[model samples]
Target: MSDATLMLSGIEKSYNRGTPGEVSVLRGVDLSVQRGEVVALVAPSGAGKSTLLHIAGLLDVADTGRVEIAGQDLTDLSDTRRTATRRADVGFIYQFHHLLPEFSALENIVLPQLAHGVPRAQAQTRAQDLLDRVGIAARADHRPAALSGGEQQRVAFCRALANEPKLLLADEPTGNLDPETSDQVFAALMDLVRGTGLSALIATHNMELAARMDRQIRLEAGQLIPLGGAQRPA
Candidate 1:
């Protein structure tokens, strides 16, 4: 196994594998993100970028190949062990904030840490610190509906990082906002990732945003290929 914070070797995934309508998504994909590295995953609609992210984040299983997080290969773990590993080693953000409408921003962030066995007081402290990191601490008591779009997404970033996962998988985290708001929210995310020295694989269609990362990889024909210049077959 490699020493990457997240790594995938020969990863493959298919839907309805034995059926006539079977579709392959990721095919023999290989990638890795080291500590403090931020990589952009670029793909057009229906390119299976999210599917790859799900497998990397441990939210879905691959049909073959290996997935390693923080140097531990997870392809052979039982469901119970996978769940525990996911809870402890991965953080995910989506295009939507997906914040609990009924809970305050602080509560949304605190809940994940609490579920991960952090004491309530410590969880609350961590949540508050995260809020402050994203410049949303002043709005910590607000519900999702009460915050602006950028603020809401900032809160979502905090929630994703609450458990201090070594790898963060974000799917178009700023895609829902206007360009101005997207920039702000993306900056906040970058700050948090850099501050914590976490590795991130962020899937985005926005080229401008992708260029801001440490490196860029494009998903084409069911495989990850480097962006720009000569490319690999799917």
Candidate 2:
């Protein structure tokens, strides 16, 4: 088995296949994310970074290729098994926090764990610990509507890591925040990721933010190209 935490080989995906409106989003893309490595995926709005992330996270399947997570080839797994693997081994963060408005920050973080069969008390403990790590433990009881944008996003981060997944996939996680808040939240995220030793593939339009990760790869014309310097246009 490969030592990589996440691997994608010959990945291909297209929409409206065989039609004039068809758009190819990815083409024979290959990547490997090793354990504890943080990779920055740099791309503009129209680039296929989201599609690649979805495939890598098992939220969507590639038209052709192999996807391996922690040495397990999950490309052909059944939907149920895929769901299980996703729940057990992958965590995702998006541009928006997407926290449950009706639930408290702590509850929002605890729900996924409950769904995964973690006991309520244990899940709550883990949720609080995550909130503490992100420096938001004081806001644990507040609902999303009552929190600031940065606070809400921090809760979302806790929710994502509630399961302690082996791999993290984030798509413009700080895009909605202002620069100062983005930087603070991003630092918390990096700390959490590094502290737990999880592999990560984070997509970002900000070159400064991308440069902070361990390595950077730009998605252009449906293919990934390694970037030695972070000055490339996203």
Candidate 3:
């Protein structure tokens, strides 16, 4: 039982580890998130932002170091246990809003909970509540094909939060939206997650969005550089 909601220490990831094409993404990266803070992760393309995020979410394994979520060390867990930990403790929002095409927004939001063994009736109630809170109750019946891009993203946000996870990991969540729409979606997300004090680490190329976070850290040459600090030598 640690105080950190999410923690990563000396994380490293390398592709083609022993071959000529080997590429290392993370080099001893360390990050920590507590209770209800929003930390912005900023990095350019090929700086391994997505790779680092996947490793943090337990969606991918790091080459070295440790990842702990809600104080439980994942390195020693079995695959099944890891999967369960991810399902219960981590909530993920991707740029594309990966909702099921056939399911209505309500159904999409409730499905994850059902998979985790929550009864259908209880999950439905929770889904409805989330939709309302996110200002999408009116759009709950709209399928992906029927909803606007913003509405679809709203539903995706609701789905991510259905399980009340401690850590919320978002990757370029607003990248696909128009500036105005992106603002709306992000505002809704802040409102919904802020009250709960969910620890969040979001990666985005947009400085405007990054400015809204508590701390902004940039990645360069396999390392994190503090934003607004003196420029490091090339």
Candidate 4:
């Protein structure tokens, strides 16, 4: 078993396969995210970054390839096992804060843990700790509608980390915010991730944010290309 937290090999995905309009999005995409390392995925729209994330997070299957998490080969897991693995090992965030409207900020974070079979009392404690870590503890009882954009997104971040997953997959996490708020929220997110010592593969169009990650990679021509001094994963 390798030390990588997430590994993808020979990944290939295409929409409308076998049809004239068939569009290949990912072509032999390979990536490896080491334990506790944060890697930025830099790509423009339509570059298939989201598709890659979905595959890596087990939310979607690749047309062909292998997906591994924590050195375990998950590519062939049954749907039930995949779901179990995903819930246990992967955390995901997106451009928008998808908190449930009726749930308070703390409740939003507690819900996933409860679903994972954590006792309600223990789940609430963990959720409150997460919210506190993200600097949103004061807003725990507020619903999404009551919080500011930054506060709402912070709640979303806490919710993502609720399960203490080994790997985090974030797609444009701060993209929906204004410039200043984006910077602040991104900082909060980085702090949370680093403090937890979790590995993350975050997709972003902002070069500045990408530079803050441990390494950067870009998707081009349907393949991942290492950027700057980052070495390609063997």
TM per candidate: 0.95, 0.96, 0.94, 0.96
Please give, for residues 93-184, the per-residue lDDT of candidate 2 as tens digits: 99999998999999999999999999999999999999999999999999999999999988998899999999999999999999999999
Q: Could you give me the TM-score of model 4 versus the true structure?
A: 0.96
| lDDT on C-alpha atoms for all candidate structures | 0.91, 0.93, 0.87, 0.93
Off by over 4 Å in 2: 229-234
C-alpha RMSD of candidate 3: 4.4
Total colliding residue pairs, candidate 1: 0
Please provide, for model 4 over 163-215, each residue's C-alpha lDDT reduced to its tens digit, 9 standing for 90 to 100.
99999999999999999999999999999998999999999999998888889
Worst 10-residue lDDT window for candidate 1 reads 225-234
Candidate ordering by lDDT (highest first) = 2, 4, 1, 3
For model 3, how does the per-residue alpha-carbon lDDT over 21-98 read when each residue is reduced to its tens digit?
999888998888767778788988889999888888989998899998877789777789888999999999999999
For candidate 1, the C-alpha RMSD (Å) to the true structure equals 4.0
Poorest lDDT segment (10 consecutive residues) of candidate 2: 225-234
The TM-score of predicted model 2 comes to 0.96
The regions of model 3 sitting more than 4 angstroms off are 228-234
- For candidate 1, give the lDDT of residue 86: 91
Better of 1 and 3 by TM-score: 1
